[model samples]
Target: MSSLDILIFIAYGLVILLVGNFLHRSKEKENSSSNYFFASNSLPWYLIGTSIIAANISAEQFIGMSGSGYAIGLGIATYEWIAALILIVVAKYFLPILIKNEIYTMPQFMAYRYDNRIKTILAVFWIALFVLVNITSILYLGALTIKILLDIPLIWAIVGLAVFTLLYSVFNGLKAIASTDIIQVFFLVSGGLMTTYLALNATSDGNGIIEGFKIIANEAPEKLHMIIKSSDPNFTYLPGWRAIFGGIWIAGIYYFGANQYIIQKALGAKNLREAQRGMAFAGFLKVLIPLIVVVPGIAAFVLDAKIDTPDGAYPWLLNTFIPSGFKGFIFAALIAAIVSSLSAIINSTSTIFTMDIYKNFFHKTASEKQLVKTGRLSGVLAMIIAASVAPLLGRVEQAFQFIQEFTGMLSPGITAIFILGLFWKKTTSNAAFFGIIISLPASIFLKFVFPAMPFLDKMLCAFLFTSFFMVVWSLLEGRMKTYPKAINVDKRMFKTDRVFNMVSIGIFIMLLALYIVFW
Candidate 1:
């Protein structure tokens, strides 16, 4: 990279810091717990939407998913495209119940539906997961990209990213995170597309974007197929038919619906309409993510780029093809993805700890000011812990699969419990608790005893087992203990806004067309 490239990168970092601090200062009151945690419930639909995408599309997508695209072809894009469909379902069916309840975190919702014990258990689990798995994986992957592209040391890269996140986000909380995400998303999308365009241009010998696409289509047609065949080696990971109809929904609902970090953005919206609209907007953007993140990997393959590991594809493209000044802009985009996700997880971790555990148990009478302080402290501690653990993930062969395997083991049970709790009036607290307990053993059994099962199939089996257990246990417990009254959510609350309904239809149609074209 030229000196001009280094200067551009430095300037990008400074601009983000300035923008985040400016947003933090713009908020009138900073002491209120609600304002600190929920961005004062003032974010509009556009900010909420862009923030959701920014938070979700981190190093994981750029590094991990692009790696999958390099190794597995366009079949890897199923995750992103299908998520566009899931986002619509979640926006329509899930967000309404959450907004009606007015909860701060998913665990808090669990408490409202079940008991404080359940809430506390899950809260601790999530806090640990956020630090250990989510933050650590992101930091590791981001550092790997930096090391590959710019020859930066892994530890310094991790520290630089962590310090940048803390400087802009820790004190001001979600307001800074959400507000900066608007700008972050712009850089993320623009840089991602620029990389894709440049890569495609290189592949087609400077024939331009459209002709480049045609060249890739004709030269490497296999990479454009969206569906993996059962006979294909990649089927074990994707499991064509099953991916569309089975375990993907379990994982998707858990992430989009019950995950605290993802849902917190929706919770911060000014109204249900805004939240729903924001989510629909996110769904639409999800459709475009593959174009930016996945296509470049395919282009790398078509150009016959020499990459030893799949994760090297994106960085290989940047270092080889992107010019100096433009390289800095793309590097800024990568940093934007990393920082936005880190700030989000940090803010959500603090929100869960402060509201669910600290306030509920340790300091039941804590004032708003005290709670806000605890939140800041929690964010800092979580960041430190995650940074410490990030370097350890260097030993993992595939950082993305390492995350998915462990997270998949737990998602089935959590999804079963949440879905049952929401819809099944007969579901008892004890049943929910035991159902969660059974899922872990079930997942382990499937993993070791039936080693041939696909990971998604294992999730499906565990989900079915847990769901059945919850129903049976709930019925059996009813004979001995009194069941709590069912949650009284008004049916009318599920109604979709007219604009959201139309937009959702358009997204679904687009997804259908993409699948049919690629299939």
Candidate 2:
């Protein structure tokens, strides 16, 4: 890369920090708990939609998912495509109840739906998951890219990314994160597409992107399959139809519906309709993500990239294919994805600890000022702790698959407790609590007992197991009586306007065509 590229990257970083700090200063005049955490419910549909994709892309998709694409072929894109459909289901059904009840956090919803004990338990669980698994994995993956681009040690790369995130997060909260995320998504999408161009163009030996596509299709037909066969070596990872109708749903629903960082943007929307429309908007963008992330990996594979591991595919593409002048814009794009996502999670973790843990148990009488202060301090502390632990993640076969499958161990249990508890009137707090407790052990036991079982299959079985226990316990408590806290519902609450419905239908058709073409 040229010196000009380095200056471009540096200038971009300064711009982002300046934007965040400017927002921070402007926001301080009206600082309040709702203002800091939820952007004072002022987010419009566009910001909500863009910010969701910005936060969702990050190192996990860029580094980790592309690694899976390199190793497992384009089939890994099922994660992105399936999420488009699930986002609709979540918006139409889940968001109505959450928005109506004025839910600030996922744990608050658990408290309203079941009991405070459930709230507290899950609050602690979420705080741990966000810090240990979610935050650290992202930090590790982002560090890999930084190390490649800057030619720095891995530990220093990790520390630099953490500091980049904290510069915006501790002071600005969701307002800064959300506003700046619009710019982040722009870079994420544009830069990702640029990388895709480099990959495909290089794959064609400079023929063209279309020629590159044709070459990939002719040479790697097996890689293009949407469904993995039992005979395929990667079948255990994907498991054919199981990816469509089985445990993947458990992961998708829980992630799009219950994950605090993803859902927090929607929670801060101008209104319920805005959030639903925003989700629908995000679904459309989801369809395009594969071209940016997965296609580049497939291109790497087709071009015979000699990467050391699957996760090395993206960085290898950047180094080998990127032209001298474009490196700065591309680096800025990658940094935008990493920092934007890290900031979103750090802000959400601070929200959970402050509202669900600190305010609820540690200082019940704390004022809004104190709560806001705690949110900032907690953001910094979480960043420090996650940065410290990130370097320990070492190497993985595929960080994206590892995250989804291992996290599946917990997702089914959570999906059961939340989804069932939302709709099933007789669900008891005891059953919900029991479901949460039993999820991990059941998943581990299943893995050991059926060592060859596809993780997708294992996830389905575990979900059914935990759901059965929840149902049985609830029914035994009393078959006919609805829990007092059960959410009251009417059909109108689930209804969407014509525009949203049309968008949903369009997304479904788009997904159908994709599977049909690729199947």
Candidate 3:
């Protein structure tokens, strides 16, 4: 890499540290859980939106997604597009209630909805998912990609990232982490766009987008097609349109709307309106992500440069397409994306552990200071665990798919309970409890024992079955029980601030037009 590139990367890191330090000062001086965990509900919509996106999309998209795209085609974009529509739902429905309830963590929302048992169960599951599946897997892939491109050891890279992420999150908490995420989001998007543009330009032909697509299309047809059924027997073959539309759609909604690490930014918003605006803004951004993440994958496939490995496409693009001077900047941005996601995971896990687990179980009367301290301590502990486990992520096939499949076992059921509980007051605590418990074991069995069932489709089935059980059980058991009054989620909770809302809607429309163009 050029000296200019190295300088730019160092400069980027300095800027992130400066912003993180600035945010650290702006945060409430008092070490309180409210500020540490929720950023004192002071985050504006834009900051929250950027932080949410930064934390949600990491090397998973940069490496796994690009790799999948290189391997699968534009079809891999189903994750982002489906999530865009889902975010709209989240903005309109979920954000309002979640903010109105004023819960610190998602599991806290569960406690309010059902009983403590359900809350504790969901919280524990989320912590496991965040630490072992989400954070560790993403870090593993991110570090591995960096190692491949830079000729470094994967273990050293993982440790370095873990140390940096833990350092800021441990002291500055979500406020510092989320604040840095705003800057990280910009770098991630810019670097992604640069890679896409350069990859398209680096083809044997010229730099026109359409011409590039055409050349690739004629050159490599397999990478462009979106049809890959389980019967295909090819190991790298992806889910088809049915899986995309049905399975991915449901999973996206659950993830963007309900997952702790993703939604914590929304939950930390200044108010319900800000939270809705933030989510809608994120929805808009989600629409644009596929352009940067998925299209490049398709580009590589069309180019057919003998880079057969999917995971290598991203690093390959950087080495081949990006200029030496700017490569450092792109690598720094990639690292920022990785660290931001790690911070988000660490902070959220700590929040859940301290609030939902510790406070609920052992220290019901814990002070905000005590809670914050515990959160920071937990953040340190969780980081160590996530870093240690990161190496194991290599064991999983299609790291992203593995994360989804296992998390899918729980997400659908949890989503059902939350959807029913939030809007439908008729859902009894018993129903919520039973719906979640039954879904996990059943989903695990179906997913492992019967892999041929189009895994996501099976998850949908499990969701439906468990939901049906909840409804049936509630009716049978709750008929005689006094019906609780309907929840009074205020309309203001769903409304967005006009400025952010207008800009967000405009972006969403633009994304829709692009989706249609690509489709």
Candidate 4:
């Protein structure tokens, strides 16, 4: 990179910090526990929407999923496109009940529906998953990307990203994080698209994206397919028949519905309507993600990118195609994705620890100010732990798939717990707890026992098996009666307005067309 590129990069850092600080100062209730964690229920649909995408699309998608695209083709896009439809389902069904119940965290919902034991246990589980898998891998991947792009040491890159996240995000809380996401999304998408355009354009020898895409179609058509056959080596990553009616549903619902880190964006909404609308907006954004993140990887493949590993596909594109001055803007976008996601994870981790563990267990009489302070401190600690562990992770091929599979380990029981706890009145606390404890073992058992089973199918099988156990346990405990603490959800609560319905239908149709064309 030239001196000009270095200057541009420095400028972006200053602007982001200034914008974040400005947003933090603008908030009157910044110190309130609710504001710190849930944005004081003051976020509009757009902020919630952009922030959700920003938090979700980090180095994982940019580097890992892009690499998956290079190797596996458009089939890898199911994770993004399927999420669009899942966001609709979550907005209509999950958010309504969660918002109505004033759910501060997913664990809090577990407690509200079942018992304090469920809440505390789930909270501990979430904190571990976020810190260990989510935060650590993100740091590892982002640092790895920085190492490749900027020629930096991986350890310093991880620490630098963590510190940058804490500087702007950990202190100001969700409000600032979500607010700054507007800028982050701009950089994230635009930078991502810039990479895509650069790769595609370069592939066609500077013709254009459309011309390059046509060339790609003529050259590597197999990369355009959305479905993989059993004979395909990558089929295990995205099993054959992976769709809404498949195991993708289980993963999608768990991610968009029960996941604390993602849902915390909607939980911070001004109202239920705003949250629902926000998810709809996020669904629309989800459709664009594979275009920005995945297409570039395919472009790299068509161009015969020289890289040692698949995950290096994106970074290789940057180092090869992106010129000097523009490097800063594109790298800034990468940082935007990394920092936004890291901050969201840290904040959510802090929220779970502060509300579910600290406030509930450590100090029942903790003041609001104290709660906020604890949250920030926990956020700092989580960053430290995640950064420390991130370096220990060795080379990961298809890090995106690794994350999904690991996260899916916990999803089966958690999904069953939330699904039954929401829709079924007979689901007792013990049944849910049983589901949680058996979740990891069930997935692990299936993994080794049925070694050939695809991870997604394994998730579905585990989820169904776990759900069966929960049902039997609940029914036997209830003696054909509803649990006492059953959630009192009305059918009307799931109803959506015309706009949200339109958004859902639009997303469904778009996904349908994409799958059909790409399939």
Clashing pairs in 4: none
Provide C-alpha RMSD values for all models, in order: 1.7, 1.8, 2.9, 1.9
Residue 504 Cα positional deviation in candidate 1, in Å, after optimal superposition: 0.1
Clashes of each: 0, 0, 0, 0
Report how far residue 160 has shifted in candidate 1, in Å. Answer: 0.3
In order of appearance, the predictions have TM-scores of 0.97, 0.97, 0.91, 0.97
Q: Candidate 1: what lDDT?
A: 0.87
Flag regions of model 1 displaced more than 4 Å.
25-28, 396-404, 479-482
- For residues 175-245, what per-residue lDDT tens digits would candidate 2 score against the true structure? 77889998889889999999999899998899999999999999887878889999998999899988888
Question: For model 1, how does the per-residue alpha-carbon lDDT over 39-62 read when each residue is reduced to its tens digit?
Answer: 878778888899889889999899
Ranking by lDDT: 4, 2, 1, 3
| Model 3 agreement with the true structure over 1-519: per-residue lDDT tens digits | 667877887798778777776677433454777788888788888888899898888888888788888767776776786777777778777777776667667887877877788888888888888887788787788888767766789899888788777766677877788778878998999887877777877664665666777777777766554456555543223456575557665677788877888888888888777777787778778878987887787777666646767877887778777888779878887888888888888888998999888987889999877888898888888878888988876775676566666677887788788788887767888888888888888788776788777766776788788888888888887785533734666665565567756766676687566546644
lDDT of 3: 0.77
Poorest 10 consecutive residues by lDDT, candidate 3: 229-238
Model 1 poorest ten-residue lDDT run: 480-489
- Candidate that beats the other on lDDT, 1 or 3, i.e. the better one: 1
